[model samples]
Target: MTLDWEPAAGRPDLLADPVAEAILKGGLTGGPEGGRKVDVAAIDPTLSDTAAFCERYGVAPEDSANCVIVAAKRGGEVRYAAVMVLAVHRADVNGVIRRHLDARKASFASQAEAVELTGMEYGGITPIGLPADWPVLVDENVTRRPFIVIGSGVRRSKLALSGEALVAVTGGQVLALTV
Candidate 1:
């Protein structure tokens, strides 16, 4: 089916986000070596609840990946970041991520902070087009799926692609970093 985007409103071009573009381009190719085909679906931007969001799209929570932005703080300083993973597991903030980022403390990004840094509506943030330095965490469960649904750079849209294709394009590291 042909994909449809939301009405434009001074938003950045879909292609302007390199990560989104890469996923889009990857979807058009045959497979991993040739890229993967992505099926895009649009929805309401306010739907941040993963379970409800998936239900609306006729997808199970297990079939969807949630992209959450986290901020690590140390010495009274705050850092903005993003992480992507399956909805079935929570982020390993105290374990894998803390060590991965070398931060003494870390937690979910505040609503205002996430909106400001990522330039995405709270429920809509996707790892695509996120700051390059921010680490994209992939839960080990995600690798087990042949295909998964992820945010499409907007809360209203989602992309479905092969797991391998996403790994190749994002160069994301697979970790047992979920609880």
Candidate 2:
């Protein structure tokens, strides 16, 4: 489970198309060393889920984050946003999110809808390369982590970065978003 981490900016092949493009387009900066904001490692695609990936990679649940797409509806309109929380915590999607988004109802987006919208595999959706209009909500606990393992927008790989870097790249709003 020893991962050979490399700067994500240098390994575009490890990222999904939109994800690579996003990174090259201001989502990240710096070279392959100290200044790099994101890093990546290949993984078994089948172990892409948070629990399985954490177990396989020997990653602590607290050091891993899960990103889920939420479909919030207000009246006749629907909005999509990404919610990020540590693997040890569950996002407060129904309560806090519904209220924050001012939606009548809030629920996880369907698999097909998620993949189609984000252009990333359902199980590997990261907050890094979402639609420009979609908000990225990050849990306060996640932001405290010095390093975190998140999706790479593709099941076959995973990205590693600091919570602050994630927030800076996605313009994430840090909040108490756990149940």
Candidate 3:
């Protein structure tokens, strides 16, 4: 099934973003049998938000994934994790995440905190190239899809990749993250 998004590699302009450039450089996942290869595509900045992007780009919500940064506190120390989930579902931050992080509670990172920690825009944060120490969690549902479009750590472009690629990222953990 051909998607409405144009191929990202064919357009050099979109590569200007570091995250998008890294993905093209090799952030993609494995081939079929393992997973679909990653792809990149430029998008309108106005459509960066979930609703607007899916609507204008002719992409269904399930085909797009949301990468969210969460923080938790334990004994006066702070830890973080990055989670990827389908737009159709929500991450169980307060439950599964808090337990996984072993924190008293887990909460979504604020716009400023997310941007500062990941060096990516709040709406554009992707799991690729996140701080290595930060746990990268992928909800099992995300991997079930053949292909998913995710943030490029910038609002100007999106990264397309197989569920395998996301699952294969070093230290990536798959869990039942959705409520």
Candidate 4:
């Protein structure tokens, strides 16, 4: 059976983004060659808050994985990066991630920087279809859950997938990287 996607309000252009296109075509995990269908849902852009989004969708915040990209500066060089952190455990910005990225200084990417570099809207970035070289760090806690809700490559929508499936697709490293 083919999976269908529901479009969100006021953002029909979202369907054109590479990331969203990837999700609609390949699913949250890209699926196995000819795998079971994965469902995609769109919501009002005003309901973009992580907690609220999950609540409306009947998913617990703890069961949702938030994908955040941080730009770090090391030796005066800036690097773009992404991480999959369980909503329950915030990314260890000052601890594990800072060291993992080998940044002399690390911080969340500014709204403008994130959108400009990733071509993804803020409040809606996922590691699934990111650039090939971008480092994707997955928090240990996220793997413990059966499934997670992540961005659908757009701010107005999100995709759900099995935790194991996510690891398999992204080839992401499960690390003790959360605060």
Best by lDDT: 2
Question: How well is each residue in 1-179 modelled by candidate 4, as lDDT tens digits?
Answer: 11234332223354327575555445443322334323355667777678777676666888778888888898879987888888888898878998988998888888888777777778887776677788888888887876567776676666656676677667788889876
TM-score of each: 0.77, 0.95, 0.85, 0.82
Q: Across residues 1-179, which tens digit of lDDT does each residue of candidate 3 receive?
A: 23334554455465435454555676343223333355566677778898888888887899788999999988988898999899999999999989988999789988999988887877889887777688998999998987778887778777777676667743579999999
Tens digit per residue, CA lDDT, model 2, 1-179: 47788878788898988899888898575323487888899999999998888888899999999999999999899999999999999999989989999999999999999999999987889998899999999999998988899998999999998888889989999989998
Q: Report model 4's TM-score to 2 decimal places.
A: 0.82
The parts of candidate 2 lying over 4 Å away from their true place are: 27-33
By summed lDDT, the worst window of 10 consecutive residues in model 1 runs over: 1-10
Estimate the overall C-alpha local distance difference test score of candidate 4: 0.70
Give all candidate RMSDs, comma-separated: 4.7, 1.7, 3.1, 4.7
* Best TM-score among the predictions, by candidate number: 2
Q: What lDDT does each candidate get? A: 0.64, 0.89, 0.76, 0.70
lDDT of 1 by residue, 6-95 (tens): 312222343226445555544443222223344455566566367767766567777778877878888888776566788887888878
- Badly placed stretches (over 4 Å) of model 3 are 1-36
The TM-score that candidate 1 achieves is 0.77
Q: By summed lDDT, which 10 consecutive residues of candidate 3 come out lowest?
A: 27-36
